[model samples]
Target: MSVVAERPVVAEESRAVRWWRRPWVGPLALVVVVFVAVSVPRYLTLDPAQSLVPPVEGFAPYYPMLVAHVLFGSVAIVSCCFQVWPAFRRRYPVAHRWIGRAYVFAGVLPAAVLATVIGAKSPFGPVARVSNVLLGLVWFGCTLAGWRAGRARRFGDHRKWMVRSFVLTISTVTNRVWGVVAGVVLGPQLETTFGGNEQYMTSTIAGLTTWLGWVVPLILAQLWLDRRPKKRARAAGRSGVPA
Candidate 1:
């Protein structure tokens, strides 16, 4: 057996893994995220009664807050899909810049603010309210840091912070996923546990999901980022240049 003959299989395997990680994996996940984000807006507009907002009385503030959160959040989520697409980012850098600007300012900032306010009034109770407040603050902080890094010409720092921000932004979907699972598992026990009060059970579950949803995904992303090589190093390797 020759060394060169044995190496071809290794090289082919490496290429397959790279292709899966790049175009296939990222694009497929992006499609799912974009689909969910786009579908959510319809519930906000077309099916308000059947939407996530609880039908509590004295709907003075909750209604407006829900609307603002949904609209701005939808904008942010949709914009994020384009911003993170590797091909779009590379081909249309200028468009990427503008989309990111709109994402941070018009989408994330307003949505986070509204989320904090709405969370305070959650029918579930103080636990969920506190979770919302924390999530909102962290989301806003990550996005602002990302924007500031870009302004300071620290592209690496900007990219890291933006990745964190986008993870938090996409947590809306994760949160819902958790919520559904919890509802299904805890459905029968809710009445017995919470004195048959749907509101109390709802509040408890919301708080639990809020913490688990975003925190777990952010942790996973951080681990991936820590393991991944720096972009400059990757480019250097590709170009046969020293890093």
Candidate 2:
């Protein structure tokens, strides 16, 4: 009798395991955690002196609004990490829905409203103010759209809009990263270009990074969204399924 060679058996990976193994998921979670840890504590002290953005001279409510905005924004960003986690959504769908409700109602709604108010009167000057206002508006609109889509049971649209909102929510972290990069590049030129006026240098970097932080990520997200359909279509073709 001839001996036949047998193929090695391979086990399929679980959805939860696959999600954890994704290249971007762990790093993204770590970045958000680090950002929240570093940025939230100072605000929690509830001292105006510890405010990241200095209070405007004539704006009596600046500090309060800033505090509210930061706190609510913190909620949005933290909840968003869970909202986007595929494993969490797949394994614990009920928890996912409740968190999603919290993210929308308690997080984005109040935060986005406060963002607009604070941004409109921002002490960072015209450029930074404009960027902040626009960012707030877009963030609010995308979130509202996402929430509506979810309620309507249009999950595909919900996912796309929520992805947009999540990216905007995390743009705060990206803003800091860009701020550091801008500082490194512009710090040396402060004397030559800004006449050693630290305020002017600071404002310029803030304005530039504020725009870059959200816009760049948004553009990348749109590109990814656009390509997803093509990827699905190609996969369908390969599998002899209707696209």
In order of appearance, the predictions have TM-scores of: 0.77, 0.92
Tens digits of per-residue lDDT, candidate 1, 59-154, equal 576876777788888788878877776666766899999999999999999999998888777766788878888899999999999999999999
Q: In model 2, what are the clashing residue pairs, if there are any?
A: none
lDDT of 2 at 146: 98
lDDT of 2 by residue, 70-171 (tens): 889988999999898876786789999999998988899899999888998988778999999999999999999999999999999999999999999999
Candidate 1 lowest-lDDT run of ten: 12-21
Those runs of model 2 whose alpha carbons end farther than 4 Å from true positions after fitting are 1-17
